[model samples]
Target chain A: MTSDVETRVVRIIAEQALLEPSDVKMTDTPVDLGIDSMGLVEAIFAIEEEFDISVPFNANDPQGSAFDISSVRSIVAAVKSLVADQTT
Target chain B: MRRVVITGAGTINPLGASVPATLDAMQEGRCGIGPLEIRDVDRLSVRIAGQVGGYDETAHFDRQQLSLYDRFTQFALLSAAEAVAQSGIAFNGALAERAGVVLGTSGGGLNTQDDNYRAVYEEGKNRVHPFIVPRLMNNAAASHISMTYNLQGPSFTVASACASSNHAMGQAAQMIRTGLADVMLTGGSEAMLCFGGVKAWEGLRVMSKEACRPFCATRTGMVQGEGAGVFVFEERDRALARGAEILAEVAGFAMTSDAGDIVTPSRHGAVRAIAGALRDAGLAPERVGYINAHGTGTTANDRTECAAVRDVFGGHAERLVISSTKSMHGHLIGGTGAVELLACLMALRDGIVAPTIGYREPDPDCALDIVPNVAREARIDVALSNAFAFGGLNAVLALARA
Candidate 1:
């Protein structure tokens, strides 16, 4: 189930950055994947839509946002946690 | 006392995308009001709007920029670019620090809101785009223009409905005249032609289903328009020092509130503002040659505005060339006054006054010299742009030949 969340989040992030999932690295930050501020927002929106879970992301101060968008792997973990909380 | 002058003017309106193109359209008395182009057009009772047609957003902005800038902000930035380019004033060092941006918009990101609301309510989407807050904020255009031009002094947005642009420009002029800043980018933009926008206006019933015919006996209601007009207001001496071609002098601006009605305009309030503008500019009413009446084509607005002009200028109202370019470009709401200033410039610089088209028979209530149906050659020394918004807020700007 965690792996499913990771795959879906990675695909959403890749789609927002206009890249293939294969091109997106687990350790790569959203900026490294060419995901701008808006791109990150789109990716987060897509993830929330996919999982039916809320993401605590704020556009005004993205760095200080609770959702860890520093790297692809971190975003996946954050989504997994949100999904688990929602389901439980 | 310091003076403020308009060194550059730019607009992307329904008439045309630039000042030269818009002026040409005005000279020919061209009408830009046409069919509804946005989504859900079938649902709107008032289907027509003056849309900025054939604008290729991809040609103007990159994908990254497209994601961030809503339509209103895009209009603001594009018009500001043209004005700043024409002015040839590079914001550097202290100039960059002192220069600022003040833009007006009644609906900053109504399109964004409309889109998201549709997604959530109509489409049953659970999530919204994360940048919705920034995109929909009223000050987004002003903030973006300040960022693009590196203006650091004071930047903000004013939202007084239709009077927004005039009020914003008035504030910028006051700042420059009172030694608050040296150069200011001031104007307004509006892009509220979305489906939700039209639906909301439909509830008010102030919109026309067919056309905008201001001062015409057959007129019904106002037509909505979407676009922007940005101008560079620099201290007169600074513009002269740089040898910038001054377009017009921002002689005076006056604002008044009726404190009377939420929707209907007050003739006394409008008259006071018109007279106060002349008093502030130190020009007699007879010195004014042109008046851009806030002839919204609505029965109440046209009659009230004409009465106000008559009250202020008395006998001079009949002699002055009065016209409503809203008859051409449509009512731009917050952006109307700024774009109408172009008509003042046309009257002052080229000695050509834009006409009020779509007129069939004159109504006795609005019986002023409405340069009807055709452009005229007039040696105008002074011009006034009137903007009366909903909620009884009125702002009028007085301009003189440069």
Candidate 2:
């Protein structure tokens, strides 16, 4: 079952990757989805705008960032966690 | 073809206000980046920058001159005055007609634009200052320098982002080399430390809130800097005839485009520029002893630049000393290559190779002799200054001891 956060995250990533939301899978990474470094930054910005959250992602050291962008599932989970924190 | 030589050089940067002072700071590896003291500082996420401290425009210029001279123009004029004085070449008669000015600046009067924009939008003001157009124009600095020096020859400005200085100086050198001009005042200046400037760069996410640590394992990203560097490039024969002191010979210069990513740097593009410069100068790869790298402290730039150096120099890369003065003075963007060229002069003339300060741990990816933390004394015959800008533009300049 796709939650609201997961659905929105997939849509945003799909928009940046120029793919259909259905084509984006939970296990897919940004590179696997053909998203470049700039595309990833834009996708993160879209996610931030959609969820009203400031994503702490530095393009210089993306791997060392706290906001996981390894896979779609990780990003969705991180967004969900951030949303939860905003509520509390 | 005529030969070109740098007769005089002057600078006003975060590192120092004069050439001697700046060299002293580079020798000591002093970091000039500190908390920015601009208006609305509390609003900015990134607060540190290489801002020229203790500068008061009123002290240097009258109220009437301040109306026409933006911060960028002021910096350019001040540096040009110092350079002209050092060269001791009074521009009059035939020399005035043959000499000109060429300056580089990415953000021309950005502070002026920022102020007027705020006045109209944020404060709901209708009318702006009348001289806004003349004050904010990109060619204002070059025009002012030409007017001040009575240079009636070719004068213009170049805006190639970070590579602006190199491109401008390259054009100046070409003009002299081709015998089209006898003397050209060339360099770059940038004053983008305003609120709008910082806000725009903050969106790029390539700025470090702390220190700029280039070629280091713990490097964060580049920090913005603001300043100006000016030099008098004269034909060798003319300089010798006048008995003027030659700083360094402008051996060669080359520029190339990556035709690749808009943001990401290409190693091949940098490699070609470095090789092209050496070829233009008729310099062997082994003869080059020092390089002032375009080390912006960002992960992508440092790695790509290091790879490019390794690809170009191969075995000699290990022995040649390379350092990024950006770590000490911060990245001046358009104005950077001009200031960094001072490091090359120091190496070729003074035997002082400036250090890449704030280097904590070595990044294996950038495995070069970075001259980290401490300045080194080495008699170098040839030196290179590298400038790679966004949009894939790369420029390199080679200099020899005079």
Candidate 3:
């Protein structure tokens, strides 16, 4: 299930940057994938819609936002946790 | 005391794309408000706006520049370019350090926000463009203008709803007066006629679905417009030294909050600002011959504005040739006040008073001489441009012949 989250998050990030999923590394941040602040927001919105989970995020203060967006793997882990928290 | 003169001015509004073009339309009493031309027009109950005609993004910007500039920013830059061209001031050394950009815009990049929101929420897109943050920030237009012009001092934005431009210009004028800056590129821009823009305005119920007929008995409500008006404000001595063509003198400005209603306007607040502006300019109420009114075509606004004029001007109100150009250009919200200031300049510079078009029957509540239907030639030694916002904020500027 955690692996499923990883695959889905990786695919979404790759799609946002118009890159192949295989080209995206788990260690890469959104900026590493050529995603800008605007693209990051779009990716966040897509993720929120995809999982039906509300992500507490503020683009103006991304570094301090509750949503973990440091790396692709961190994002997947954060989403899995949020989904679990929402379902419970 | 330092005097501020308008050395250059430019605008891309519903009336026209340039200062001369807009003034010509105003002189002809042309109606610039028409059918809405945007996406999802069918969903909106109101379908009319003062849209800029014959605008081509590709014609104005290359692909690279287009990616960074939003509609509002583009309008600001284009209008500022015209103004700066007219001024012919080279911002190279000390001038660049002392000159800055201050602009007003209520909805900075609403079109960009709406498009991206639709893409993610409706189309389920995974990514938005990378420049969204820069494209959508409220200060984006001012920042871009500063960067383009190489202005290094006091660049910022003022957002006070409809009074945004007036407040911004007033701040710029003060900055020049107080020795903060020598010159300032100031005015306002708005591009809020998109799907989301109209959708949000629909909730207000202050919009007219047909036309903007300000001060008319059959007036319905206000109409939204999108465009920009920019000006180069310089010190009088500097302009004289450089032999710049002075358009009009920005004599005095005053701002006052109604401290009353969120939507409804306050007569007391409006009167205070008007009288305060005259006082600030050191002119008697009788000295003013023309007034550019903030007549939004709404029932409450026109009546209240008239009452305020009467209260401040007394017997002089009957002799004052007050008119609302919004009847032609619609209400540009944050950008309206700056655009209307052009009419005041026309009165001062060209001795032409732009008329309030679309006026039918006169309401008793608004019994002042509203220079109806046709432009009039008048010797306007002193003119006032009034802007009263929805949040009970009021700003008034007094202008004189240069």
Candidate 4:
């Protein structure tokens, strides 16, 4: 199941950053994968385009429940859940 | 009143990032417009814009900083860094607080908004990156500039469609003149060249399909652009005392509104803005050697701007070297005036006047000596920059040799 999730994570990075699965190193952080803020934004844009969700500016305000995006896998996991919710 | 002068300049436009490079590109009439490659543009109406090229976000900032800043903010910070680095002035405790920051932007984190919308509705993602607010707000650029340089002065953001930067620059100058601050980092930034972002422009129905052709009879509409241009403004006395190189004196500034329609521009308003700026500068209309026009290339804007010029200076309008740098840089929206003001300062410093590229035929209506197509070499005594935006916001800045 983790391997399946790993593939989906690789696909997310590939789809958003205009990179190949090989380009995205699973062992690497977003920084290692060359995913900077703008690239992260492009990733977010891709997820939005792929799926159709409107996330507000501050979802993770200490006052609020902002989800952690510590790594590519985490972002992918959150996105998968969102996609699952939509499909269901 | 204390006189305000431009001490340094920096930018990252479609053409190039640095002063000499960008000016050289514009002087050579380099068009930065190309096919959109940011996203899948197969479905979008607008396929091109003057997007900044070769911008590496992580290289510029740490991961935590990147998380907090939007692309526009990062552009602003980078541009501001360039300006401060070139200034050769160190900001201490007192100067930092008195030295304010005023930057402008039409779309604050708009790309973020578009992407977030996509993530929630389509991707079903409930988790957004924690720093979305810092990335998207219009003032993030100003804040970042202040934090980076220890500038605590009156820092704020200006939003007035494309006129935002001009307003911010003018306001910063005013703050210095009023003895509010000793220095300021001023200008504008914008990077809204995304798919849905570009699509929103289609609603305006005033964009060119091919390229931006300002002042040319074949011109269709304004071309969109993305980037930032920032300048360090300081008191002439302070700069001289500190042995700072004064680029050009920011002599006067004036802002007005049409109070009419949102989209359609007003000739009266344009005339008021130009004339008002001249009066504030306390110079005869003939004294201004160059006029950096807000020539948006739209049929309505060009005609209205031409009439306003005619109303103010009459035959002198022909004598003055007037041009729209927008022909090449596209309408940078918020950042246009900052770069345009640089054109004004450049005209003041170097004798050569920037040209309105793509100008083929003078629409009989806009029959001013619009330094057509080619750059002209002439010593400029005084230069004026004009910026008029949606909602009828108008800001005119006057500059002269120090």
Quote model 3's TM-score. Answer: 0.82
- lDDT tens string, model 4, B338-393? 87777887788888788888777667878888888788889889899988888999
Number of the top-ranking candidate, with DockQ as the measure: 2
lDDT of 3: 0.91
Residue range B1-402, candidate 2, lDDT tens digits? 899999989999999999999999999999999999898988888899999999999989999999999999999998999899999999999999899999999999999999999999999999999999999999999999999999999999999999999999999999999978899999999999999999888788888989899999989899999999999999999999999999999998999999998999999999999999999999999989999999999999999999999999999999999999999888898899999999999999999999999999989999999999999999999999999999999999999989
lDDT of each: 0.90, 0.94, 0.91, 0.81
Q: After superposition, how far is residue B228 of candidate 2 from its true place, in Å?
A: 0.5
True contacts kept of 2: 0.60
The reply for model 4, stretches above 4 Å from the true place, is A1-88
Please report, as a residue range, the 10-residue window in candidate 3 chain B with the lowest summed lDDT. B201-210
lDDT of 1 at B244: 97
- State in Å the error of residue B31, model 4: 1.2
> Each predicted complex: what DockQ?
0.01, 0.75, 0.01, 0.01
> lDDT tens string, model 1, B1-402?
799999999999999999999999999999999998988798666789899999999999998888889999999999999999999999988898889998889999999999999999999999997899998899999998888888999899999999999999999999999999999999999999999888877655467777888988778788999999999999999999989999999999899999997887899999999998999999999999999888888878999999999998888888998999998989999899889999999999999999999999989988888988899999999999999999999999999999
- Which stretches of candidate 3 lie above 4 Å from their native place? A1-88
Candidate 1's clash total is: 0
Q: What is the lDDT of residue B339 in candidate 3?
A: 94
Candidate of highest lDDT: 2
